[model samples]
Target: MTFDLRPWQLADFPAYQALITAPAIATAIGIDAKSTVSQQQAFENDLYQTYQAAILIDGVPQGSIVAYQRANELGEPLVNEADIAYFLSPAFWGHGIMTDVITAFIAQLPPHFTLWADVLADNIGSLRVLEKVGFTNHGTYIDLFGRQIIQFHLYR
Candidate 1:
């Protein structure tokens, strides 16, 4: 299967909504599965402000990947560091699609930047993907939502 990544567009909203609201995907990303249309719209708008892209398979969006400035405990953005995140449709899971997508995404980033990712401790799939792509485990913590999270980082 041919894979590509590109900036999200207005036309992707419907697919984006569907992707994010799926129970497994929503829980993984901290999005409420029962969120209203307006709430989802707001969330989508916020994502558009970040450095994000649609993961396309044979020219159809199947998932998304994004990197945004990391924030300090006090909510200030960090220089030269970004927190990366991604999600793929359930149908695409376990096919090495995300591993390939993330590898390509990291390759295009500025060499001076450091990338971080926080995965729910129970998210074994994502943890493996990060490791396969060269991210180091920095240990774990309980997030604000009370979820056990594992932190990983890659320094270019």
Candidate 2:
């Protein structure tokens, strides 16, 4: 099973749209404003403008991880470092799916030394994922969309 990270494409809209609407997953990931097809189209189009990856299982798109960010407010300056937000279908959860996907991206991508992620403070599952993958807590955002979040990072 070769798990590779593919570039995001407009054709990924339907699968992504479906993932975004799954309530259990969406709520846990973050606020999901029910998006229209046009909105979804615009999103798929927009992501092409960034450094993103489609988590492909043997070349079939399973999920996506988006990398975007500014310099961290709570940490030292590290160029090419970024904050990321991403998701996969609940069906794809716990299959060592994201673990493999993230590790590969971090290795091949240009930001060789710095990476960070933030999750709601109450989101234990997400916190675990980040920690298991080597990110540590920086601090917390009192309310990101009305829920407090703990920031995590991997830096050298």
Which candidate ranks first by TM-score, i.e. highest?
1
Global lDDT of each model? 0.85, 0.70
Q: Estimate each model's TM-score.
A: 0.90, 0.79
Give candidate 1's whole-model lDDT.
0.85
Pairs clashing within candidate 1? none
Note the residue pairs that clash in candidate 2. Answer: none
lDDT of 1 by residue, 1-156 (tens): 568999888767777888888889888887777777754664465367457889998788888898888789999988879989899999989899999999898887778889999999999999999999999999999998999999999998
Highest lDDT against the true fold, candidate: 1
Per-residue lDDT tens digits for candidate 2, residues 26-106, read 675653547576447545643763568877776677677877655556766446777777676677777766776777777
